[model samples]
Structures are given as structure tokens and as C-alpha cells.
Target: MKLISWNVNGLRAVVKKDFAEIFKELDADVFSIQETKLQEGQIDLELAGYHQYFFYAQKKGYSGTAVFTKQEPISFKQGLDIEEFDDEGRTITLEFPDFYLINSYTPNSQPKLKRIDYRMRYDDALRAYMLKLSADKPVVLCGDLNVAHEEIDLKNPKSNHKNPGFSDQERNKFTELLDSGFIDSFRSLHPDEAKYSWWSYRFNARKNNAGWRIDYFVVSQNGKDLISNADILNDVYGSDHCPIELDLDIKGE
Candidate 1:
């Protein structure tokens, strides 16, 4: 099956920028979006062959996520059952016949590292929740994780080491998550690839190829052998972040 995840930045803004056309081109079986920044009735999307599921943040015009899938999931969940994290509308979990799909938009640490504590707490809670889910079935977790896990993940890691997204604290949390039975699908497939999925809107970073590979498709370790491919659509435009895709061949076990 083909699954794609993207942090659209803002769904309303991109819809006018050929979002629908790009959707058609990708033709994924499941498409997940993060950082929607919208609420109910703000905009309507007509995806002919997909069933839409959205979880909007209680705060207006803020963090949000959505999933559009051609196949109906056996069950769907919105958050991690934690009120503190649930308020942000950052997660969506879909239980299929064979696996669980967890789509997330991780919290970003502010300029002064103001939200670092909260972001770390979020990481702790999310990792525990994912581990719990994995006990039942394999998990396909994807979206804008908001951190560059290693030097290879960003163009200028030395200068960014102290930056919010590239901080040691955030990177270690990601490493912990991977150590807990999850595999970064893209890195696993193309270990030497250096292209990124996100670029800074400042300083014409995108034009200069200054970017960070913060988005990801992570699967449970047990499901690693099922992965066929993982890719980044860097050429696609509209948002500062690009779409990352993963293709898996499962026998429906």
C-alpha cells in the first residue's frame, strides 16, 4: 500500500495552490496531513475516492491533523488519551485490519527554547503510547516530527546544534523513540540520501537548498521487512515542508 504524509503548513492556503491537482498526481491509498491550522467549516475538500478524518486543535487556527484514506479503517482514535497533549490536536491513530497508523504533528520548541519542556514531555508520552500500541500490532507512524535526529538530517548541523529543532535534547528523544522498536523508513531505505523535507522560509533557504529532514515515516521494527520504498517529494511546492511517502507490501497478516 502507498501512504504519504505532509505538513501542509496551512490547508486553506495550499488548496488554492493546486493542492487538489497534486493530490491526484500522488494517488496514494492513504494521505495524511499535519499542521492544518484550521477549524470546522473553514474550508471544504472534495476527495472523490477517500474517506476523510480530521482532528482539529481546540485553539483556533493552530496545530491540527487529518487523514484521507481510500480504505476504511477498522477503528480511529484522535489523541493519546492525555488531556495535556490532546489539546493541541496533534495526533490521529487508525487501526487497520493488520496494523495501526499513527499520524502526528509534533510540537516545536520556540525560539528561546520556551516550549522545550513541553515538547520533551510530549515525546515521553507519545513514545509510551506508541509502545503500548505496538504490543497489539505493527505501527506506521508518520508526519512532521519537528526534529533533525542527526547531523545527516540537516544541511548545517554544526550551526544548528543549539537551535530549537536541532537541540541535543530533542535529538535524543528521537533517538530514544527509534531505540524503542521503531525504524525511520526513509533513512533505512536510502541511508546515504541527503535531501530534506523541510526548509526555512527565512533567508531564501529553500532556494539555497538549506533544509532539514524533520518529516518521517517510522514503522515498528517488526514491520521493517514489509517496507518497499520511502521517498521525499522535494520538488513539490506550496508549503515550506514537502511530502514524505512510504510504500509497504503487506499480506494482511
Candidate 2:
């Protein structure tokens, strides 16, 4: 089975840039998108042969997430049972027969680490939530986690050490999550590969390949064997962030 995750930045904006064509090219069985930046009725997308589910934020043109799957889910839910975080429409959990698929757009620790506390709270809560889900079955978690876990995850790790996404606090939280029986699929497969999924539009970052591997496809430790491949689609462009793909051996219910 093929699964793909992308932070489209903005759904409407990407659509204007040939999102449909790119979507067709990928042909993922389950496609998840984050940072959709939309509220209800902002736009309509027709994805033939796919079931679409969206979680829109209360605020217009803000953080949001959505999923498109060829196979219907046995059950699905939005949010992590936290009112404050749910207000941003940051998560979607879909249950198939064998596993739970979680797509998330984690909160960003703003510049100067202004929101580090909030981000930490989110990290702790989400870790607990994923643990609970994994207790039942394997879980496939993906999307822009908003942090570069280690020095290898970004082009200039030293300079970014204190940056919002690369702060010590945020990175340690990621470490704690992995220590709790989860796997960072891409890093597990490509230990030495230095690739990135998100780049700033400024300083010609994309052109210069100065980027951060903030987006990910994480799975429960038990589900690691099911991952056939994890990839960063840097060539595919629409948003500042590119798409990440994961191929799994498991199938839909």
C-alpha cells in the first residue's frame, strides 16, 4: 500500500498550481495533507475514486488537515480530545482493519521560542495519545511535525540549534517520543541521507538545497517491518514544503 503526506501550505493556492496533476502522478492509496489553511466552503476538490475527509479550523484560512483514501475507513476522528489544540484542526485519525492512520500538523514553536511551552504541551499530549492508539494496533503517523529532530535533519544544524524548530527542548521531546516505542521511518531507513522536506522561500533556500526535514512518516515500533520505503519528494513543488511518501506492506480492510 502507498501512503503520501504533504504540507500543502494552502489547499486553494496549490490547486491553482496543478495539484490535481501532481496528485494523479503520485497515485497514493492514502494521501494526507496538512496546513490546508482553509475553513468550510473555501474550496471544493473532486477526487474521483477517493473518500475525502477534512478537519477545518474554526478560524478562516488557518491551520487545518485533510485526508483522501481509496479505501473507506472503518472509523475516523478529528483532534486528540484536547479542546485547545483541537481548535486548530491539527489532527485526523482514521482506522482501518489492521492499523490506525494519524495525520498531524503539529504546533510550531514560534520565533525566539515564544510558544515553546505550548508546543511542549502539545508534544506531551500527542505522545500519550499515540501511545494509547498504538496499544490497540500499529499506527502510521505522518505530517509536518515542525521540528528537526537531530543535527542530521537540517542543512545547517549548528546555526539552527536555537531556532524555533531546532531548539533543544523540541528535539528532546522528539527523542522521548521515539524512546516510547515509535519509529521515525525515514531516518531509520536512511540514517546518513541528508534530505529535507521543508525550505524557506527566502534566501533561495529551495534552490540552494538549504532545508529542514521537519515532515515525517512515523510508525509504531511494531509497524516498522511494514514500511517498504520512505521518500522525500523534493522535486514535486507547490508549497514551500514538498511531499513525503511511504510504501507499506499492509493493506486496507
Candidate 3:
């Protein structure tokens, strides 16, 4: 199964940039999206062979996430089952006959770490949710997780030290999650490759290839063998962040 994840930055804006063509070109079996920045009924996508599901934040045009899959899931749910976390509509869980897929848009700590506390809570909550699901069956987690876990993850780690997405606290939280029996799919395969998934729109970051490898496809350790391929599609463009692809050997059944 070919699964892909991307933080479009803004779904509406990207759609205007020929997102339909791009989507058709990628042709993912499951396309998970983050930072949709829209509410229900804001846009209509005519993806003939896909079933689209979206979780919109309570606040208009803010944080949101979506998933489009060619096969129908046995069950699906929105949120992490926490009221505050559910408010921003950052997660969607789909249950297939074989495993569970969690598409997430992790909260940013914001400038100067203003929202660090909230972000930490989000990380903890999400980790717990993943752990809970993993206890029952293997889980596939994907999306823009916000933090760049290691020095090799960002183009300039020293300069970005303690920044919202590069702080020690944020990085530790990511470490903790992985320690709780998960695998960072991309880094596992391309250990030393400096390919990045997200870049700043400012300072011509994308043009210069100055970016962070924040978007991910994390699998439960139990399902690690299911990963067939993981890659960063730096060549595709529609938003500040590029699309990430993860291929698995399993099917919906």
C-alpha cells in the first residue's frame, strides 16, 4: 500500500496552485494531509476514486487535517478523545482490517515558545493514544509533527536551537514517543541523508533547500517490517512543505 502525507500549509491556496494535477500525479493509496486551514463545506474536491475525510478545528481557518483513501476503512474517528486537543481538530484515526492509521497535525509551540506548555501536553496525549492503539494492533502514524528530532533533521540546528520546533523539550518529547515502541520510518532507512520535508516560506528557504525534516511516517515497532519504502518527495511543490511517501507491504483486506 502506498501512503503519503503532506502539510499543504493551506488547502485552498494549494488547490489554486493546481493541487488536483499534483494529487493525480502522486496517486497515493492513502493521502494524509495536515494544516488544511479550512472548515467543513469550505471546498469540494472531485477526487473520483478517493474517499475524503476531514476534521476541522473549532476556530475558523486555523488548524485542520484530512485523509483521502482509495479503500474504505472499517471505522474512523476524529480527535484524541481529549476535549481541549479535539478543539483544534488535529487528528483522525482510521481502522482497517489489519491496522489503525492515525493522521496528525501536531501543534506548534509558537514563537518564543509561547505555547510550549500546550504543545507538550499535545505530544504526551498523542503518544498515549498511539500506545493505546498499538496495544491492540499495529499503528501507522503520519503527518507534520512540528518538531525536528535531531541535529541532522534541520539545515541549521545550531542557529535554530531552542526555537519553537527545535527546542530541547520538543525534541525530547519526540524521543519519548519513539522510545515507546515506534519507528521513524524515513530516518530508519535514510539515516544520514539530509533530505528535509518542511521549509520556511520566508528568506527563500525552499529555494535554498534550507528545511526541516518534521513530517513523518511513524510505525509501531510491531509493524516495522511492514514498511517497504519511505522517501521525501522534495521535487513536488504546492506548499512550504513537501510530500512524504511511505509504502507498506500490507493491505486493507
What's the lDDT for residue 217 in model 3? Answer: 97
- Candidate 2 has an lDDT of 0.94
In candidate 2 the C-alpha lDDT for residue 12 amounts to: 95
Alpha carbon lDDT of each predicted model: 0.93, 0.94, 0.94
TM-score of 2: 0.98
RMSD of each: 1.2, 1.1, 1.1
lDDT tens digits, residue span 112-167, model 3: 99999999999999999999999998999999999999999999999999998999
Clash pairs (backbone) in predicted model 2: none
Candidate 3 whole-model C-alpha lDDT, 0 to 1: 0.94
Worst 10 residues of 1 by lDDT: 244-253
Q: Write the per-residue lDDT of candidate 1 for residues 131-150, one digit (tens) a residue.
A: 99999989999999999998
Clashing pairs in 1: none
Q: Which is better, 1 or 2, measured by lDDT? A: 2
What lDDT is reached at residue 188 by model 3? Answer: 96
